[model samples]
Target: MFMRRSHDFTFTGWHMAGVVCLFFGTIISVNVYMAYQAVHSWSGLVVENTYVASQQFNGKVEEAKHLAASGLSGTLTVGAGMIRYRMVDAADRPVDADELTVRFKRPVGDHQDFELLLSPVGSGVHEARREVLPGHWIVEVTGLKSGERILHHSKRIAVTGPAS
Candidate 1:
């Protein structure tokens, strides 16, 4: 006659402790990773004051509409050691301004933001000699006439190299 042995397992305090630790540990690890990514990926500063920005939002929108209706458009070109912009009106005629400024800003942060006041080279064309770094950028071009903003344009672009 052969004797058979039965195997049994019990869920003890140690097992329960391990289960709780694993559950909480996973949650904590995910939270820490998310926090790290969030802090490193974005500047978290869209405006100096949210309330003030919100209050001025409508006015800004109206201004943008007016500017758009004016049909003033610009073409920006970045070269190895130069930045050029050409402005035109709705009729595709050259548009001149008293002052034109091009601002280069990063999409996620402002650390690399900079401005270049372009000098006109005739026929609504402006140029500046500056080396722009290769990366993703948001270009904001503002044109002023008699100290008042006349044209505001924003564009998102990816720069592979400064050659063009």
Candidate 2:
């Protein structure tokens, strides 16, 4: 002969409600977190006016092509509170410019963006003294002579050490 035991446990509506709440709560919590990160990490605006920028895109492209065909290039070095640029032509001869400027921009935000005007240091070399923060940056260098653009260069770099 055998004896059987009875238990009081049961799956009720309250239990179903709790499971549903937990599943949806997790999903909603994750979505809110992702939304917050997306909003704070990067500003969505690249230019102030999208239509105006689009209208000038072709002209800018042509300018870039012309600048590239000129065979004029520059080497940029940034570190230790100094920014140096040396411009050269196709023949590897030193090139001179009337004015030169460098723009340092953060990839994600504009808060740290800044521009520095470089002073000529003889032999086609330009120098600027500034402590650049160590991080990923988009650097833009421009050279002009007689109010006309002579050199335009942009590059991405990572600085892992201190700015000093």
Candidate 3:
């Protein structure tokens, strides 16, 4: 005859309740953590007023057309801890501006943003050497002549750690 040793541990309501609580507790905790992350990462508004911005959209497009009509164009390059900007006129000749303001910003956040007032380093070449971290950035280049904006260019670029 073989005898099996029996213990007094049984599946009781308390045990079931503990298991259920642990299961739901894990689910609820995870949900809470994910919710916090989602809310914290995103800002509620993209713009102050979408309606006003939309209304002015046509004018902006028309302005861009007018700029293109003037044959005023600009090229921006970000590399080697430096930013280089060049403007050319309709005749494909280099255009020089009195002053250039460059606004560097992250696409999603306004915290990591900086503005640089650059002077002409060479003929039609405006440059500034700044050590910026590698990430996605929006470069807004504004060229002004006699305090009037002549060129407005927005460029998106990915910054690399190494000079390229």
Candidate 4:
């Protein structure tokens, strides 16, 4: 009887220890999973905010096209510390306006592109103080009243040396 009792007590002790270990392990796993979820949620919010901001800017540009249709003709010149865009009206008259925004296509493999806002100095001329990269680029002019795009009058401009 004594030996039997001793054996039973040993088995009970081992079972109790296993149960404790399993409980601790389960709690730890749950905590780790919760932490991972929190981090994922935070990153998702940041990405969503970035996407929203970009969409807002695009919408504004679309609206400007209808508002500045009359002033959306001209040549865009990109050079060192300056970008010049020209526009002509339907009556062959040149209208000068300030704040001509130039947006360039994002570089290949890059997620963001360049945007420059230029001011008009003379008739049909808009100027900005910003250096543009010399490569394949797409230019779009905003702030025109004729609902036409002037900056990207053509497909793409290859800046070999400085923009003339």
Best model per lDDT: 2
* All candidates: TM-score: 0.90, 0.91, 0.70, 0.47
lDDT of 3 by residue, 1-164 (tens): 98877875689999999999999999999999999987776565677999999999999898888776788888888777787888898776999999999998887767778999877987698988887778888888888899877888888989877634
The Cα local distance difference test for each model comes to 0.92, 0.93, 0.85, 0.65
User: Total clashes, candidate 3?
Assistant: 0
Candidate 1 structure quality by residue, lDDT tens digits, 134-157: 899999999999998889999998
The RMSD (Cα, Å) of candidate 3 is: 4.1
Ranking by TM-score: 2, 1, 3, 4
In TM-score terms, candidate 1 sits at 0.90
Model 4 bad stretches (over 4 Å): 1-72, 144-154, 162-164
The superposed Cα distance between candidate 3 and the true structure at residue 105, in angstroms, equals 1.4
Cα lDDT of candidate 1 equals 0.92
* Backbone clashes in model 1, listed as residue pairs: none
**Pairs of colliding residues, candidate 3:** none
lDDT of 4 by residue, 56-98 (tens): 9877677557545734457777777677877767676777654
Q: Count the backbone clashes (under 3 Å) in each candidate.
A: 0, 0, 0, 12
Point to the candidate with the largest TM-score.
Answer: 2
Question: What is the model-wide C-alpha lDDT for candidate 2?
Answer: 0.93
